[model samples]
Target: MATHMTSKKIQNRMKRRVALNKGMSGIFLLATSFGVFILGVLFYQILTEGIPYINLEFLTGKLSTNPDRAGIMGAILGTLWLMAVVIPVTIILGVGTAIYNELYAKQGKLQSIIQTNISNLSGVPSIVYGILGMTIFANMLNLGSVVLAGGLTMSLLVLPIVIVSSQEALRAVPGYLSEASIGLGATKWQTIKNIILPAALPGILTGSILALSRAIGETAPLVVLGIPALLLPFPGGLFDRFTVLPMQIYYWTLDASLVGEYQFLASATIIVLLIMLFILNGTAIVIRNKFQRRY
Candidate 1:
């Protein structure tokens, strides 16, 4: 009888455990389904409202106060020019900092402080970087609100993300590969360049592209930098004052209440921005798949 009672208690405990597990699983599934449903609704609205406005004229024309005549070509060119500055600056500085921190920096108080600050900076609001840029790059440095200033501001905003991601990718490389290279009489720099970098390339590229995706979408920094919205010539180089897709979307959305057609234009710009992000992320995925190593 005592043995029977113990078995019954054990079964009851197991049943409760199973019930809890199933309950949590159901909750997670429900949450995921809710998020996906919301995203589907948003995409549906954007597609329905924006598709009619995406003609060649819309894509190629210059910005105008007249909504019908307005085009996003200048904005597109400006965005591209901004990226020209951001990509190289972020990759070189971010990757270089990561390499120094992970491979060369002696682990100590200074390194710990630096790492902690970088991690914290990654969480800093984009607007703060904008303010910093406005103060230093725009005002103090007299760079004005040109493409170069905006690009550098965006670079500062995303730099910590790139550095942190690069560090993580560097860490993911297997130690054995480096050990083997060193055993083969490879210098430290030689091993890093030949073995470590190639092995970690997939993760690094994925992270950098993701960071850049954020940079391209951010409106707050550019807005704070006072980037113009309309009637601007195409940005030919970094020194020219410019606008980007986000800025256009922002101004159009604001003007939408006055003119309903501006809403559709804003939606169209959002679509283009989404397409650009998709292209970037798709390239990252392709590169990652081609170079990804199991070990």
Candidate 2:
């Protein structure tokens, strides 16, 4: 009788624990569903208001004082020029820094300090980078609010992210690969170049591309650097004045409160911006998946 009572008590306790866990899981699911529902509603609203306004004329024409005639051609060209500068600079510097730290730097206080600073920088506000860019690139270097200055500023903001991600990717490579390369009479640089980099390329590409995507969407830094939303000419060079899709959307959204029709224009521009982001993110996903499968 005593043994039976003990087993029954244990079974009751286990049942209660399971019930509690199920209740907590149900609550979490409800919360997640609510958030998704809200996002779905917002996307539906944007699609409804923006789709009708998007046309070839809206895409290829220049911004105008008249709402019906406004377009984002200049903004699109400017954004592309900015990316041309940002992509090369960020990849070179970010990957180089990661390689040095992970593959060459000796473990010490200096390395720790560098690592800490890089991590801290990842959390710094975007507007702060803009100020730094304004003072250094704009005022000191006389780059002004041109494409080069904007691109450089955005690169700085995303540099830390790239470095951290690259480092993680580099560290993920198997130690045996490097050992084998060395055993085969390869130099340190040769091992890294021939074996490590190819193995790590997928992670590096995914991280860097994601960072660039974030840079392209940033508005605060550009605003601080004084990018105007009214660039009439298409950006033909890095030195030319430029404005990006986010800036145009921002200016139009503000104007929408007064003109009303500008809201539809803003929505249409947002559609284009979303498409650009989707393409970039999709590319990253594909590359990441391909490398994962191969490796």
Candidate 3:
């Protein structure tokens, strides 16, 4: 009788555990579905409101005070010019810092402190980076609100993320690969170039692209830097005054109440920005996949 009671208690406990598991699973499924549904709604709204406005003239037009006459071509050109400065500076500085920290720096208190600060920086608000950029790049360096200043500011904003992701990618490369390279009489640089880097390239590219995506969409920093939303001339070079899609969208959205058409214009700019993001992300995925297969 005592043995029978123990068996019954055990079965009851197991049944309760199973019940809890099912409940948690149901909750997770509901959460995921809710997120997906929200995203679907957003996409639907954007497509409906924005697609009608996109056309060849709209694509090739310039910004104007009149909502009907305004085109985002200047903004598009500025965004591309900003990226021209951002990509090289971020990759070079961010990746170089990551390589040094991960491969060369001796693990110590200083290294720990540096790593912790970098992680913290990644979480810092975009606006703070904007202030920093304004003080240093804009005022101190005299770069003003040009594309170079904006690009450098953006580079600083996303640098920590790129560094952290690159470090993680580097760490993920197998220990044996580097060891084997060394055993085969390869130097540190040779080993990194020939083995570790190629192995980690896919992950590095994925992280860098993600960071760049954030930079491209951010409005706060550009706003703080006084990047104009209605530049008449297209940005002809890095030093030229410019505006980006996000800035255009932001200003238009704020002016939408005065001019209802500005709202549609904002949506159209959003559509363009989304298309650029999709293309950028798709290209990154393709390149990363190819490298992943190679490595």
lDDT of 3 at 257: 92
Top TM-score model: 1
Q: Tell me model 3's lDDT, rounded to 2 decimals.
A: 0.92
- Per-residue error at 67 for model 2, in Å? 0.7
Sorted on TM-score, best first, the list reads 1, 3, 2
Residue 179 of model 3, lDDT score: 97
Residue 166 of model 3, lDDT score: 96
lDDT value, residue 18 of candidate 1 = 100
Taken over the whole model, the C-alpha lDDT of each candidate is: 0.95, 0.94, 0.92
- Candidate 2, residue 80: Cα displacement in angstroms equals 0.6
Task: For candidate 2, write residues 1-295 as lDDT tens digits.
Answer: 9999999999999999999999999999999999999999988888898999999999999989999889999999988999999999999999999999999999999999999999999999999999999999999999999999999999999999999999999999998999999999999999999999989999999999999999889999999999999846888998999999999999999999999999989988888999999999999999998987343
Clashing pairs in 2: none
For all predicted structures, in order, the TM-scores are 0.97, 0.94, 0.95
Top lDDT model: 1
Model 1 has an lDDT value of 0.95
Alpha-carbon RMSD, candidate 3 = 1.7
Off by over 4 Å in 3: 1-10, 293-295
